[model samples]
Target: MVKKNNASNKSGNFKTNTIYAGDCIEAMNRLPEGSIDLIFADPPYNLQLGGDLHRPDNSRVDGVDDNWDKFSNFRAYDDFTHDWLKSARRVLKHNGSLWVIGSYHNIFRVGSVLQDLGYWLLNDIVWRKSNPMPNFRGTRFTNAHETLIWCARSKDARYTFNYDAMKNMNDGLQMRSDWTLPLCTGDERLKGEDGNKLHPTQKPESLLYRVIMAATKPGDIVLDPFF
Candidate 1:
């Protein structure tokens, strides 16, 4: 079983490899400045679904309709994003890097905020899903990709980039901005007591593994604000 640590103290005594449960902004604020080596955040995409989605077979689609994904409006989401990002930056070491993933619904805003906060944009990686859900209604193209923004604390900050590791993972070729990976399914996906998915947006561990390998060392501290 995955161990979870509820971080409720303000003394910033966090340990590595332990999952923390609480508001990300508050948790990050409790950490000391320049304490984290890397951070990977998969924030809400704020997908404002009007109603239930149905497949061609009339089966209800299990879309991301969780309450956590909901916001009063764009301004509200922007506020939330800014708060967590500010805290994240405060805890990140000067040479550390950060990665954030989101869909079209919110990535643009996130990128803008990152730039405004003095984060030097590195690359916007596209996670192209090999087996994406089709748009059953045919109203639009199938959303087959999500964007990941990688950045450093500032323009001159030295950061880690495991170019050789990434090339090795890419069959001896240098990996491009586009990454092709499968969605979380089969036994890799976690299920709840009801046999349903535990998290609506549980990312594939392959994706996280690549991110960690590319940006961190074996003993470096890695934080996941949305874990």
Candidate 2:
């Protein structure tokens, strides 16, 4: 169920496992400081598409052209990134960790802002899509992977990392920086009444499952600011 809260009480209580619908910055600001244990953000990629994209068969490609993904310019996007990252840091516990995923169009900028905000870098993971959509235009190599940045609240913070669980998940071998997963499609993709995808950039649950399992223990609060 989705939870909605306007503000914290005098005792500074925050709700968990509830989805709130609103501007992420404002919603996060309403929470008490140090209330969140972990955060996973999938922000806008600011893809500047010149026109419609089509496959070699002349069928239209469903790209990330949603209005929310649009931005005025690089500076505007950078400012938005900084504001939300700062807000996320404020609500995170001292030992909490954060994960942000993005494509090449904006990962570099996001990484720079994360560093500027003093978020200690842990590892930059690459999610290689097993069944990525082919680049029909053939203008560039098939865009097959996205990047995920993991970081702690600060450099000295002792954060959670389930090393053994990850190893077990990998069949006794240590999990590496590159993860191979499939895109959200088939029955896993949430659809609208018209049979269209409800959310264009919905990530695969398998990806989030591994991330949450590797970084958090049972009953840990995991926040998704961009949900």
Candidate 3:
């Protein structure tokens, strides 16, 4: 099924395979409108963290302090999000749906902007992590979950829903909005040269496996803007 070559050693399967790396907004602009069947985006969280966030022991806690995570401020981040979302919308088929995941730091603003752009919300799912990081300083409760927003392209768009499949996957029960899953650990975690994490924010493959299987059919075109 592999065909288009956006990157070496990776072919776009029937124009459906993943593109390894590129600017999402610019890349999406090249795709024809109403071409994508579904979209899954994991945008920057706008954590707004600065300097080296350290533990009480003075050792640095690994944080998303990369260039990609940096923005001038909240307004700048919002604008960047809006631009990419608009591009995503343009490429989505009328019946196509989208799912975006984010933490408390940014999900509210994302949802508000999505509503303002006329996307009809289908559900807001909470992905609860079983072994979440504790609040080291005990200043607040442990941040243990992330939110995912599911929506259709527009109010009257016809979208795909696999109710029976979801039920079967959930031990013959209907799956709810709250999903309990574990964070990537042990061998699943990507390591760098020093045996540390290579990617700071690689989501668990299990989460994606469920999401893709639940939302897509064998040949459905899935657009992952975040790559």
Candidate 4:
């Protein structure tokens, strides 16, 4: 049986709004079982980039080529995904929920593992970027969207869902799975010392705002492993 620690009862080991810097699986294992309520993950999408991409202006398009996005093979990536997801599941309460965002490179794989680990999927949302970057080479159609998978620990788990709040946000209409939100830009995006964008995959606050408003209450203990 899962030992669910409700938010009203405090635990010394867990701290809200704190980043425990270490391996994701290791860090999550340190927390008490059934402690977290909502978890939002933006894991590395192992996009195997063959080469660099450039725009019509000749400026190189700095795609997601970071070392973190690299995995030796599909097997290695799957193992990594399983480990972190297992830890996340253990730390999640019986009624807790998790949300993961990924591209075609890994979302399907992650979804399979989530089900294997007993996570009952709620919805697969498509975040259509209102201003997505154009495919410079035009080798394929513009990849203008990403998918977010929302799930509970199990099918029977009574999870949080503010349907009325969501309806209100959507102007009295039921919210659709296809969200047309823009990517993180302008002041919302962090800049480094050289005045370049710091993080390559920064999710916009508007996107998360809708997520939180729809599925979680104000005091819910939301855990973001990599957002």
Query: lDDT (0-100) at residue 101 of candidate 3?
Result: 96
Give, for candidate 3, the lowest lDDT window spanning 10 residues: 5-14
Model 2 CA lDDT for position 79: 98
lDDT of each residue in 183-210, candidate 2, tens digit only: 9989999999999998989999999999
Best by lDDT: 1
Please write out the lDDT profile of model 1 over residues 1-227, one tens digit for every residue.
55687777546577777777888888888888999999999999999999999988899988899898999999999999999999999999999999999999999999999999999999999999999999888989999999999999999999999999999999999989999999999999899889999888889999999999999988999999987
Better model by lDDT: candidate 1 vs candidate 2: 1
Model 2 residue 153 distance off true place after TM-score fit, in angstroms:
0.9
Superposition TM-score, candidate 4 onto the true structure? 0.93
lDDT (C-alpha) at residue 88 in model 2: 99
Order the candidates by lDDT, highest first. Answer: 1, 2, 4, 3
- lDDT (CA) per prediction: 0.92, 0.91, 0.84, 0.89
TM-score for all models, in order of appearance? 0.97, 0.95, 0.90, 0.93
Ordering by TM-score: 1, 2, 4, 3
RMSD of 3: 3.1
Which clashing pairs does model 1 show?
none
What candidate 1 gets wrong by more than 4 Å, as runs, is none
| Cα misplacement distance, residue 205 of candidate 2 (Å) | 0.8
Model 3 clashing-pair count: 1
Clashes of 1: 0
- Runs in model 3 lying further than 4 Å from the true structure: 1-14, 55-58
| Predicted candidate 4 versus true structure: per-residue lDDT over 139-216, tens digit per residue | 889999999999999999999999999888889999899999999888999999898898899999999998888778
Better of 1 and 3 by TM-score: 1
